[model samples]
Structures are given as C-alpha cells and as structure tokens.
Target: MSPRLVRIGLGLWFCAIVLFLLFPLVFLIPLSFNESEILSFPPTTWSLRWYRVLFLDTSWSNALWLSVKIGVLVTILSLFIGTASALAIVRHRLPGAGLLYGLSIAPLIVPSIVIALGMFMLFARLQWLESLTTLVFAHTVVAVPYVIVVVSAALRNLDETIERAARVLGADPWRTFLLVTLPALRPAILAGAMFAFFASFDDLVITLFVSGAMETLPLRIWNDLNLRLDPTVAAASCVMVAMSMIGLGIAEFARSAGLRRLRMENTDG
Candidate 1:
C-alpha cells in the first residue's frame, strides 16, 4: 500500500476508536437533562431540574462533599509518598532500588478487588472500618502509583546538571531540591495530583468494602442505580465527567508550559 493510503487508513481507525470510546458519554449528556426523572436518551422535555436536585438534595450533596474531601486527602498523601519514593529510586539510587520501585507500584499490578478484600479483612480485624483516615490511606495505596510513574518519568528527563549547578553554587541539599528540583517537577506533580484525586473519587469497589455507612458520590450513585433509574444519576455523572476533563486540561496546560520553560532555560544556558 502507498504511504498516503496507509495514513488515510490510520486516520480512519483513530476516528473509529475515538467514537467507540465516547459513545456512552455522548448519550449521557442528553439523558442528564431529562425532566421526567427517568434516565432516557433523546430526553423528552429537556430541563435542568436533575442538575438542581444533584446540588440541592442533601444526600447527593453530602456524598459529593465527602468524596471531594477524600480525594483531596488522597492527592496530598500520594504526592508526598510517591514523590519521595521516586526521588529515592531515581535520584538517590538507593540499594535495592529496582525492588523498591516494584514494591511501591505493586498495587497497580495487583487487582483492586483483591487489595480491597485484604484491606477489609485487616481493617475489620483491627476495628478500623468506616474511619475516614483509614479510607484515605486505602485510597492512597492505589493512587500513589500514578504519582510514582509520572514523577519518575519527569525525573528521568530532568537534567541532573542543573541540580549539580545549584549545589556547586553553595546551596544545601534541601535548598537545591526545594528551589530547583521541585520547581522543575511542578507539572508532573500537578498531573499526579489530578490522577490521585480522581482515583480516590471514582473508586467504588474498594470504597464499598470499607466505607461502611459513609456514602461517597460513587456509593450514592450505586445505590441510586440499584433502587431506581433517575436523571439525577446522569446529572451527577455528567458533573463528574466535566470535572475530570477540566482537571486533565489543566494538567496538560501545566505540562506544556513547564516544557516550554525548560526549553527556554536550556537555550539560555
């Protein structure tokens, strides 16, 4: 086949894949506007009533607030732990770094359900179930891997000479890292924060096992699905999707800007 024909075929394949992935999301938007409370596509009598219900209803609003709180906590914990692990592995090159890296990311390799079950058993035995701090720690276990991956990749690409230059200029290790290394890593850290937050926010299976009486947004959605089909659920889903897209856009913008700044710095050097 000619190169041009191959390019055309690839383009068509990409478009098809995009459509397939977005098919459900495309239908969900209209369903969220259905005035009747029923979740039906090609919504009849379109209205914003469901969105209002999502915000005004105590159950939905409370669940959403809980999820946000947990997501923020998970993001903070993951960033600290994951960044430290990445730095130790990539920069310090500690003994058994490969083994340490594998262990750190082992949660990503393991099935979440298996992890959830183990956590449930352990927490139950310790009588720690339903505790907010325990829930945050559990989410952090899964979310930290994303941070490790992003920060590790960024650290690998970062110029070590820059750090060395900072040190040679009489900067202490802490100052060099805080002033130079951390600034360079802002984009990766932000992207990792986004991933960590969403991982905690969207988790349903693990949360189901440990949350006990606490209803997160995902738990609320699950209950709604089981009890009734309503446009409120669709509206909630749309809101979650919108928030995720916004977070992703911000992360991408930060990454691009950081890259541009690095390029300019390199040129000046």
Candidate 2:
C-alpha cells in the first residue's frame, strides 16, 4: 500500500478502537440521566433526581466521603513508600535492586482476588477487619505500584547532573532532594497520586473481602446493584466517571506545565 493509504488506515484503526472503548460510556452517561428508576437505554424522559439522591442520601454520601478519605490516605502512603523504593532502585542503585523493584510491584502482578483473600485471612486472624486503618493500608498495597512505575520512569529520565550540581554547591543530600529533585518530580508524583487515588477509590474486590461492615463508595454501589437496579447507582457511577476525568485533566495540565518549565530551563541553560 502507498504511505498515504497506510496513514489513513492507521488513523481509521485508532478511531475504531477509541469508539469501541467508549461505546459503554456513550450508553452509560445517557442512562444515568434517565428519569425512570429502571436503567433502560434511550431514556423516554430525563431528570436529575438520582443525582440529587446520591448527594442527599446519607448512606451514599457517607460512603463517598469514606472512599475519598481512604483514597487520600492511600495516596500519601503510596507516594512516600513508592518514591523511596524508586530512588533506591533507580538512583542509588541499591543492592538487590532488581529483586526489590520486583517486590515493590508484586501487588500489580498478583491477582487482586488472591491478594484480597490473603488479606482477609490475615486481618481476620488479627481481628482487624472493618478498621479504617486496615482499609487504608490494604489499598496502599495495591496503589503503590502505580507510584513506583511513574516515579521510576521519571527518575530515569531526570538529569543526574542537576542533583550532582546541587551537591557540588555545598547542598546536603536531604536539601538537594527536597529542593532540586522533588520539584523536578512534581509532575510524575502528581500523576502517580491521581492513579493511586483511583486505585483505592474504585477498588471493590479487596474492599469486599476486607471491609466487613465498612462501606466505601464501590461497596455501596455493589450492594445497590445486588439488591435493586436503582438509578442512583448509575448516578453514582457518572459522578465517579466525572471525578476520574477531572483528576486526569488536572494531572495532564500539571504534566504539560512541568514539561514547559523543563524546556524553558534547558533553553536558559
């Protein structure tokens, strides 16, 4: 085929894949606005009643708040642990770095249900199920891999000479990291934070096994789905989708700004 034909074929293929992935969302968003309690497609009427219920109902609101709280906690923990792990593996070149890196990302490789079952057994033995702290830590186990991957990639791309220059200028290791390295890593860290939060917020399988009486937003949605096809669940899902998009937008903006700043710095240098 001609090069022009190849390019057109590739573009068409990409468009098809995108449409295939978004086919569900195209239906979901509309169904969320359906006036009827039933989750039928192509709504006969449209209303925001379900959205109102999602906000006004204490159960749904409380579950959302709990999920947000846990997500934030998990994000912070993941950043701390994952960044340290990445620095050790990528920057310091620690002994057994390969093994450590594998261990760090092991959660991603392991099936979530297997992890959930293991956690359930352990937490049950400790009588720690349903604890907020337990949930945060459990979520953190899965969320940290995202941070490690992002920070490790960024660390690899980062100019080591900048850090070396800071050290040569009489800055201590701690000061160099806090001022020079951390600022450079802001974009990757933010992106990782977004991923970590979503990992916790959308987690259901592990939460189901470990949460016990505690209800995060996903658990609440699952419960609703099991009991009835409430339009409220659809509304909650739309809210989550909106939040995910908003988080993605913010992360993309930060990444772009960081890249522009890096370019400007390079130009100045």
Candidate 3:
C-alpha cells in the first residue's frame, strides 16, 4: 500500500476505536437530561430534576462524600509509599531491588477479584471489614502501583548529575533530594497522585467485596441499580464524569507547568 493509504487506514482505525470506547458514555449523557422517571432514549423532556435528586438525597450525598474522603486518603498514602519504593529501587543498589519492584507492581497484574478476595478474608480475620480506614488501605494497595510506575519512569529519566552537584556543594542526602530530586520529579508525583485518586474513586470490585454495609459511591450506584432503574443514576454518573474531567484538567495543568519550569531551569543552566 502507498504511504498515504497507510496513513488513511491508521486515522480511520483511531477514529473507530475512539467511537467504540465512547459510544456507551455518549448514550448515557442523553439519558441524564431525561425528565422522565424512567431511563428512555431521546428524553421526552430535558430538566435537571434528576441532578437535584443527587444533591438532595442523603444516601447519594453521603456516598459521594465518603468516596471523596477515601480517595483523598488513598492518594496521600499511595504517593508516600510509592514514591519511597520507586526512589529505593532507582537510586539504591539494593540486593533485591528487582524483586521489590516486582512486588510493588504485582497488584496491577494480579486479578482484582483475587486481591479483593484475599483482602476480604484478611480484613475479616482482623475484624477490619466495613471500616473507612480498611477501605482506604485496600485502595492504596491498587493505587500505589500507578504511583510507582509514573514516579519510577520520571526518576529513571532524571539527570542524576543535578542531584550529585547538590551533594557536592555540602548538601546532605535529604537536602539534595528535597532541593534537586524532588523538584525534578514533581510533575510525575502530581500525575501519580491524580492517578491514585481516580483509581480509588472509581474502584468497584474490591469495594464490593470488602465494603460490607458501608456504601461508597459505586456501592450506592450498584444498590440503586439493583432496587430500580432510576434516571437519578444517570445524573449521578454525569456528575462523576464532570468531577473526573475537572480533576484531570487541574492535574494536567499542574504537570504542564512543572514541565515548563523544569525546561526553563535546564535551559538557564
């Protein structure tokens, strides 16, 4: 085939993939505006009644609040643990660095259900089930891998000479890291925290297994679906999508600003 033909084929393929992935979300967006009690296509009326329900309904509001709180905690815990693990693997010539790295990333490859089951059993034994702290810890297990992957890549690509220069200038190891290394990795750290936040916020499988009577947003949605098919669920989903987009936008802006500053510093040096 000609080069032009190949380019055309690739563009068409990309468009097809995008459409396939977004088709369901596109279908759902229309239903959210549905003023009717039932979820129907080509909504008979467009109103914010369902959106109002999401805010006024105590169950939904509480679920949303709990999910946000847990997500924030998970983000903080994951970033702290993951950044330390990544730094250890990349900076130190530890005897079992490769093994430790593999262990850190194992959750990503291991089936979520398997992890969920194990956590359920462990939490049950420890009598930690149905607790927010336990949920946050469980989420951190999955979220940490994302943080490690992002931070590890940033660390690997970092120019070690800058950190060495700080050390040579009478800076201690901690000072060198805080002044040189941490600033250089800030973009990746911010991105990783965002990933961690979303991972916990959107999680369902593990939450279902371990949440028990506790209701996160996903659990509330599941319960709603089981009880009845309400247009309110559609409104809730749209709100979740909006929140996710806003978060991603903020994180992208921060990451880009950090990158620009790093580039400017490198150029000046």
Q: In terms of TM-score, which candidate is strongest? A: 1
Give the range of the ten consecutive residues with the poorest summed lDDT in model 3.
260-269
Q: Model 1 TM-score? A: 0.94
Residue 218 CA error for candidate 3 (Å)? 1.0
**Against the hidden true structure, what lDDT does model 3 obtain?**
0.90
Question: Comparing 1 and 2 by TM-score, which wins?
Answer: 1
Query: Clash pairs of candidate 3?
Result: none
Error of 1 at 186 (Å): 0.7
The digit string of per-residue lDDT tens for model 1 on 185-207 reads 99999988998999999999899
Model 2 alpha-carbon miss at residue 145, Å: 1.0
Error of 3 at 77 (Å): 0.7
Off by over 4 Å in 1: 1-7, 259-269
TM-score of each: 0.94, 0.93, 0.92
**lDDT of candidates 1 onward, in order:** 0.92, 0.92, 0.90
For residue 64, model 1's alpha carbon misses the true position, in angstroms, by 0.6
Model 2 segments more than 4 A misplaced: 1-5, 256-269
- Model 2's lDDT to the true fold? 0.92
